[model samples]
Structure formats: C-alpha cells, structure tokens
Target: MRVAIVTVGDELLAGDTVNTNAAWLGERLTERGVGVERVVTLPDRVGDIARVVNEYRAEYDAVLVTGGLGPTHDDLTMDGVAAAFGREVVESEEALEWLAEAGGYTADDLAEGTADIPRGARMLKNPEGVAPGCVIGSVYVLPGVPAEMKAMFETVAEEFSGEVEHVASVVADEPESALIDRIDELRDRFDVTVGSYPGDSVRVKIQGGEAEAEAAAAWLRERVDLKETGE
Candidate 1:
C-alpha cells in the first residue's frame, strides 16, 4: 500500500518539537510493507490541514494524519478533517464514552464538544489518551502525541499491509566518490532503489523485492570489495 503521512503541529513547523512522528511512522509503515510516498508537516490550521489531507487522500492509498487532536485551542486536526470531507463536526457518543472511562471528564462536559468528531467517520479507540482518532474515507486521523499515535496505529496496522520489501547494503571504507559509477551501474541493472550515506565509511543501501534485492547485492559484491562493518 502506498501512504502519505501528515504531521500537524505549529510546534513541529517552528522546530520546537522534533518530527519524530514522521520518521517513526515511515519506519513502521515500511516494516509493514507499506510504501510511504510523502510526508507533510503543517501548522494546526483547519484550512491547511484540510487541504493537505484532501490532496494526499487522492494521491495515495491512505493518508495517516497525526497531531492537533487534543482539547486545546490549537488542536484543529478533527475540525480540519471534517472540513476536508464536507462533513459536520458533532459530539461523538463513542468518543465521549471513552473519555468518560479515561476519567477527569463527565458526560455533560464532553457533550459541550470536547469529543467532537466528523459525522460518519469511524472512531479509532485511543487507549493511551483522551482524544480518539477517527477515519473518514482513506484518511486516518491520529493524535500527535507519540505514545498515543503509536498505540492507535498498532491497533489497525493490518489494514496498511502491502508487498514486503527486501533490503541489502554495502559498506565501504572508501569515499562515496569512488562508488558513483558502480552505484549507477547497479541502478541500471536492477529494480532496486539505492541510498548512499557518507560518514567515516560510505554506506550504500539497496531496497527492492526479495529476489531483485538479493541479485543486486550479489552484483555489487562481485564488482566491489564491500567493507565488513557488521552494521
């Protein structure tokens, strides 16, 4: 499955909050065989969030949106999602019940719109926090809190499964410049995607389907003496 991740927070855009959620989601999705095509970080504005979510939903098989699902004023994710679908925001009884069980809130308090959700969206149970996630169409709304987002994602991870990827890597103590031709040759010869990282040693990572990845690795090994980094 192809997916896009939308991380919503002014703090993230301001560099106050590191965008670990995007990285984490990318890793988790890849491990599940889902390819993450894009990642977007936006301020907690209803229009911005809605526009991005709507755009990605049409472009990708699924869009995982994180952040802005709290009780605070800036938590506009839910509202943004509703606006994207042209749906009205209404107090969700399911979310209100969940919040009541989580404590610190009464049914009447939640009735005042603390547990608002987009009409016709399915509620995603949030075990770690009060704000429940909701899925409207292919867009999966999630809490911005790392712990909460992780938990909610795990609950529905099966839905995002896709073709399993095989990864192979070549590490060389030589500079990246030494392997440019060989890397280009590998790309021309195989269906793998090549990624290069330069540091004390240069690392070339190859990713593709199982047989293709193995063949690419073998080709690279035959052409160059790859360093045995054991990484």
Candidate 2:
C-alpha cells in the first residue's frame, strides 16, 4: 500500500512543535510494510489545507491527515477537508452515538462543531476521545493527538494493508555515487525500487517481494561494505 501523510498544525509549520506524528506514523507504516510516498506539514489555512488534501488524495492510494481536530478555532481541518472534496459538512450520527458513550455528551454537544464531518464520509471511531474522524474516499481525517489518531486509524484496520515485503539498510565508507550503478543493477535484477537517502550515512530502501528482498540482502552483504568515512 502506498500512502501520503498530511500533518496539519501551525505549531508544526512554525517549528514550535516537533512533527512526531509524521515520524511515528511513517515508522508504523513501514513496519507494516506499507510505503509512505510523502509527508507534509501545513499551517492551519484553508487554501493550503485544501490544496494539499486534493493533491495528495489524487496522487496516492491513501491520504492520512492529522491535527486540527479539537473544538477550537484552530481546528479548521474538517472545513478544509470539506472544501477539498467540495462537500458540505454535517453532524454524523455514528459520531454522535460514539461520543455519547465515551463522555456522556448530550445530543447537543455531539450535534455541533467536533461531530461535524464532511458529508458522505465514513466515521472513523476514536475510542480515546469524543471527536470522531471520518474517511471520505481515500482521505482520512484524524485527531492531532498521537494517541487519539492511532486509535482512530485502528478503526479502519481493513483499508491499510501491505502486500509486498520491504526492507532498508545503511551503507557508508564510500560516496553515494558509488551506489548509482549498484542501485540500477539491483533494480533490474530484483524488480525492486532502491532509493538512496544521503546523510551521515546512506540509507538504501529496497522495496519488493520477499524473495527479491532476500536476494538483494544477500547481494549487498557480499558486495557492499560500511566503514563510515562518507557515503
């Protein structure tokens, strides 16, 4: 499965808050063998949110958005998401019922603001909090709080599944240029996508079948070495 992540928060864009959700979600997705194609953090602006939402929703198989979900002025995620799909917002009965069970909220409390989801969206149950998320098409609206967002994601367990086995490894002691031909060779040999991420070390992600991954692993062990000079 290929997925895109949208982290919505002024705090994150302004660098006041670390984007732990992005990293955490990416790690979880990776361990699940899903490929995260992109991750972006946007300030709480309708135009920005809508642009990103529409773009990613069309580009990737799945879109996951986190933050701006509470009953606060800054929480314009639902509105932006609605605009992205050109849909109206309405209170979700499923969310209303779920909220009542979680916090004893009256219908009034559950009828406004937080419970307002994009029309025709599927409500994603948030067992950790009262505000429920919704999945419209491939777009997912999740809570900002990591704990709550994770719970909401679990509610849609069947949607995000990875069919391919993938793995990554680090190699240093040589320039990344050294791996250019090696990467191409591996791609042709295993029908895998090998990406070279440069930094203090070179992180090569090998994504393909289990047999191909094993083949790539054995090939690398025999031909690749890491001495940490620079790669």
Candidate 3:
C-alpha cells in the first residue's frame, strides 16, 4: 500500500532538530514493501495540519502523521487530524486508563488537556510515554518523540500492509558514476529498480521482485563481483 508521512512540530519546521523519523520510517516501510509516497513537515499549526491531512488522504491509501501528541501547548497534531476528519474531541476511556498509568494522570489528573481525543478515532496506545495517539479516518496521529513513535508504530504496523523485500550487495572501491547508467539499465531489465549508493565503498540496492530477484542478483555478480573490475 502507498503511504504518506506527516511530521508535525515546531522543532522540525524551525530546523532546531533533524527530522530523522521520516527517513527512518520511510526506510522501514520500504523494506516491508510499502511505498512511502510523500513526506511533509508542518509547524504546530492546527489549520495547516488539517489541510495537509485532508489533502493527502485523498491521494494516498494511508497517511502516517507524527509529532504533536504531547500535553504541552505546542502539541496540536491530534487537533489538526481531528479537524481534517470533521470530528469533535472527546475523552477516551482507553486513553484515560492508559494515560492514568502511562502518562501519570490520576483520576483527578485526567483534565481537559490530557484525556481528550477525536471522536470515533481508534486509540493507539502509547506504552513508551503519555499522549496516546489515535487514528481518525485515514490519518494516524503519532507521537513526536522518536522512541515513543517507534513503540506506538510497532503496536500498529500490521494494520498498514504492503510488504516489500529488498536485496543489496556492497561493491568495495567502486564509483557510483561508473555504475549509475548500468544500474538504470538493469532497473529496466530486472523487475525491480536498482539504486547505486556512493561512499568510500559502493552499495547497490536492488528492489525486491519475486520474478526477477534471482536473475538480478546473478547479473550483479557477473558485472560487479566475479571480475573485480575495480572501477
């Protein structure tokens, strides 16, 4: 399935922190055969988040939104997602229980800020931290903290399915310029795409395809490994 990612936070938009979550999640999704079609960054703006969430839902099969699920003021990811789906915020029982335990919110501590969520959203428990995320319509409001987001993601990964398997090999002491053209050509010949990664040692990543995986591997062995071209 095709998916889009929305990372919401002031830190990301202001460049105070690198948005490693997107790249990391994208790679994971790719490895599982899911296509990460789009990645978007937004400030803690409710209107902007709602707009993008609504727009992308029409284009992609799923949209995985991260950031802004904290109790602090700038945490507005849920609000935007809720708005995008035209829903009202309500206190979630599952969330309340999880929050009371996970978020340090007691019965009295379950105030307006900590226990509310969009109506009809399926609760995605946050065991790593407080601020439980929810899935409103097609938009999934996830945590901004990498650790929490990853934890929450692990709990719900099976729901988003499109499984991709990739195979790659390393070519020591080779230039990507020497391989790009051939790799692109191989992309056509093989059922999957070939990408040449540049570094002190080169890496070639071949996309997974049931029909062409073995053949593609054989071809790479011939051109890159067997002769040790050293180009």
Candidate 4:
C-alpha cells in the first residue's frame, strides 16, 4: 500500500517545531510494509489542507494527516478534511462518549466543538488524549501529539499492508567513494535497493525481498572488508 503523510502546523513551517510526527509516521508505516510516497508539512490553513488531502487521496492508496487536530483555534485539520469531501462538520456522539469515558472533560469542554467531526467519518478512538481522530474516505486523520498519534495509529495499523521488505546492512571501513563501483555492481546483480552513507564508516543498506537483500549484502561483504553487519 502506498500512502502520503500530511503534517499540518504553522510552527512546523516556521521551524519552531521539529516535524518528528512525519518521521515517526514514516518509520511506522514503512515497518508495516506500506510505502510512504510523500511527507508534506503545511500551515494550519483549511483550504491548503483540503487541497493537499484531496489531491493525495486520489493519487495514493491512503493519506495520513497529523497535527492541527485539537480544541484550539488553529486546529483546522478536521475542517479541511470535511471540505475535501464536500461534507459538513457535525458533532459525533461516539467521540463524545469516548471523551466522557476518558474523564477530566467537563460538559463545557465537550461543547467546545471537541466532539465535532467530518460528516461520514469513522471515529478513531484516541487512547492517549481527549481529541479523537477520524477516517474520511482514504484519509486517516491523527493528532499532533506524539503519544496520541502513536496510540491512534496502532488502532488502524492493520488496515495497511504491502510487500514486506527485508533489510540488511553492513559497515565497510573504506570510504563510500572506494565502494561506489562495487555497490553499482551489486545493484545490477540483485533486485534490491542499495544506499551508502559515509560516516565514521561507510554504512551500506540493502533492502528488498529476503533472498534479494541477503544476496546483495553477501555480495557486498565478499567485495569489501565489512567492519560490521546487520541492522
């Protein structure tokens, strides 16, 4: 399954907040074998959010949106999603009940549009926070808080699946330049994606199907003096 991740926040665009949510979601989705095609960070504007979500939903199998989901005025993700589908924001009883059970929320808190969701959206229970997320069409909305996002993603992780990629890594004492030719050969010889990073040592990553990745790693090992293996 191919997916796009949309992280919304003005703070992110201004560099005030690091976009850890995008990176975290990317890793989680990759581990589940879902290919993340794009990660976009946008300002907390309903129109921009609606445009991107609408576009990505048509291109990708799913679009996961995080951030801009809260009780505050800047929280516009739900509204954007509703606009994307030409729907209205309505109070969700399921979300209200969940929020009530979660405790610490007064009637005033619930009445603050916290229970409002895009029409026709399926409420996603937030085990870690008061604000609930939802799924409208192929778009899965999530919270900006790292804890809440992680918890909510777990509830729907099973919905996404694709070819499970196997990864093998090896560290070569040689510089990346010295192994460039051999890496090229490995790629040509095996159906695996290879990446070489130059750090204290040249770290080579081989990713693909189990057999292909193993073969590519083994090929690299035979050509270079590997300082370390496995990742």
Best by TM-score: 4
Model 1, 19-65: lDDT tens digits are 99999999999998998999989998999988988888898999999
Tens-digit lDDT string for candidate 3 (111-202): 45666689899998987877788887777778888999998988888877776665755463557777766677777787876666776667
For candidate 4, the lDDT comes to 0.90
| Over 4 Å off, model 1 | 102-105, 109-112, 228-231
- Per-candidate TM equals 0.92, 0.83, 0.87, 0.93
**At residue 138, what lDDT does model 2 achieve?**
92
For model 1, how big is the CA root-mean-square deviation? 2.0
Model 4 lDDT tens row, 135-166: 98899999998899999999999999988799
1 or 4, which is superior by lDDT?
Answer: 4
Ranking of all predicted structures according to lDDT, beginning with the best and ending with the worst: 4, 1, 2, 3
* lDDT of model number 1: 0.88
User: Clashes per prediction?
Assistant: 0, 0, 3, 0
Q: What's the C-alpha lDDT at position 10 in model 1?
A: 96
Q: Please report the TM-score between candidate 2 and the true structure.
A: 0.83
Question: Candidate 2 has which clashing residue pairs, if any?
Answer: none
Per-residue lDDT tens digits for candidate 2, residues 93-153, read 8877877877888886543587889999998888887788889989989998889988877
